[model samples]
Target: MRRLAALVSLLLLPLLLPTPAQAAATPLQVYGAWHCGDDACIWGNVRSTTDFDAKNHWLIDRGDGRPSVNVVVLSFVHPVKLLHKTTDAQTLDGVPRGMTADIVNYFAGRGIRVMLSIGGITYTTAWNSALAENAAQFGRNAAEVAQRLGVGIEIDYEENSKPDLVGLQAFIDAYRSVLPYDPSGANPAARLTIDLAAGDRWLIDIGRKATADWLRTDTPVLDYANAMVPARQPSSSDAIANWQEHLDGKPTYSPPIPPLAPAKFTGAFYIAEGNKVRAECADFTASLQKSTGSFVQTAAPKGAGLTPGMLGYMFWAAERPSTKGVTTTPPNSCEGGVGGGATAYAIPIPMPALRQS
Candidate 1:
């Protein structure tokens, strides 16, 4: 009788143990910042090494010989020009003059990953036109740029109201055809990703489609999605609420949107807000990154994902997001906020292997 009772207890012990999601959380794999210039997301001019490094040194060496983030995304490559394969004195092989190899090498040399963003809010019409014209070709062109630069590509098509989902799919397919998904993270060009709105409310169609089909862990399409920041900086509670929406999808929609895996995306915050240095860029303790750190690390999976916590954090506009906004340059660098956060999080440089599920 005693032996039988012990056997029963031993069998039930497995059930009592915490599931993977409830277990100890893992550190964030991705910590990135998007780079933009004063020219409204366009790096228009080719800058010399000295000039470029002077303004951007803070990114590479965050006060203590460490980088602020593991990755840097160069913002706003013209989709129309890339689609048309346009080239001129200002553009080379459909890439901007400013997005040169030297610039990419600057970061890559320092154990940082670099990516090129293909669209922004200002290029909504352009994205529509390009998708309408030749999305497959556009994807091929983007793949070509990625190959040439040895960098990854980010699809930032912010067509909230009427996104060209079909075209976007074709674009993704074509790009994947050229550079297939690489789980090993060896091929940089294979590291494709997309940008989603802060919450499931906006970018409804794209978000619905992305969450349902593209971002599935069983059969992944893009590497991941970025939950971009809202118009203004959101408080810790507001930001978590927004992130929670992605974890808990809307079921009442036409074809119910599914919950995204916590490992499949990163939450974004504003580094600076129009001439004002945000806490994310200036002060770590007061920053949303610090306030929301625990939630970001241990939030359990809702309906999808076996892992706890979202992928990691991403900061908005590294250099100068806008002409009017405070630039993340020199005296106003993100060493305190972003850098301190990096140290606090012990963010792995060159971005270690990410959790697939």
Candidate 2:
């Protein structure tokens, strides 16, 4: 009799569950911050791993309510000045291959994932040389640095007009081959990802590589791609449309671009919008759960994409790279630079989706 009663309860479980409209709103997906400490720090002092104080809110909580980001991608490990030759040497805040575990751990201890982002717009010359000549060394150097510092690696190389696809592959392969992931290792949560042009038009070549090749492989070398801010901010609806256009090719191209599944793209936004024309983004605080699926090309509720509902969110920066000391929409807590939302922290996973995993 008890077994029959239990079986009846199991069968009725679906009825007991909340319907789509009745469910609670889901948590935001992919809450991340780009920590640009590699010298955009003149207005804001350079961030040293060993350093500490009240202003290090980017590294830790300061009793305020700013959401602690789940992921922190340390900015810019640019190539050395010798652009003609391939060199393994890279620099962070003018320190060749300099990185420290203290900063990595300061956030890691708080359950955040840390990564090292290589190449920014300013380091264009170095990118041309490193990828053109020292591809393997550059990749190895980046991976090795992240390995040493106990963090992941992010490729932000922006030379899209003529990207070195062959060299890039070599770089990725080298980085992956050397730094095998072991959850128990010092940098167990380490991941290898890349920065993509915000939209399809600018980094045409690189975007092609991402859609036609990188994302389609069974064992993709990259974990995912971050859609950096496009020239203009499109609304959340427009943003999703742009992502769809990239993944599922629009009709205008001479040869319609091949489409990739929606799962690989993570739309990035500028967190500290002030006077600039904002990307047509939805409210920064808009809940992923509350969004509908008009843009994502799926029947699932908004934000659900690929393996994890839409790879998740990445802020242009943790500290505004150029907007030092400028007051942002949400006034900052840290000094010298604009620290938009560092008062608290959050996990990157989608709340409702985590249950499936």
TM-score of each: 0.92, 0.70
**Candidate achieving the largest lDDT:** 1
**TM-score for predicted model 1 compared with the true structure:** 0.92
**lDDT (10s digit) by residue, model 1, range 1-357:** 999999999999999999675456669889989999556577888888788888888788879998988999999898898898778876777788899999999999999999999988988899999999999999999999999999999999899887899999999999999999887788889999999999888889999988888888899888999999999999999999999999998888777788999999999999968768888998899999999999999877899989999999999988888878688888898989999899999999988867889
Q: Ten residues in a row with the worst lDDT in model 2?
A: 348-357
Which residue runs of candidate 1 sit more than 4 Å off their true CA positions? 1-23
Q: How does candidate 2 fare on TM-score?
A: 0.70
Candidate 2 global CA lDDT score: 0.55
lDDT of each: 0.90, 0.55
RMSD of 2: 8.9
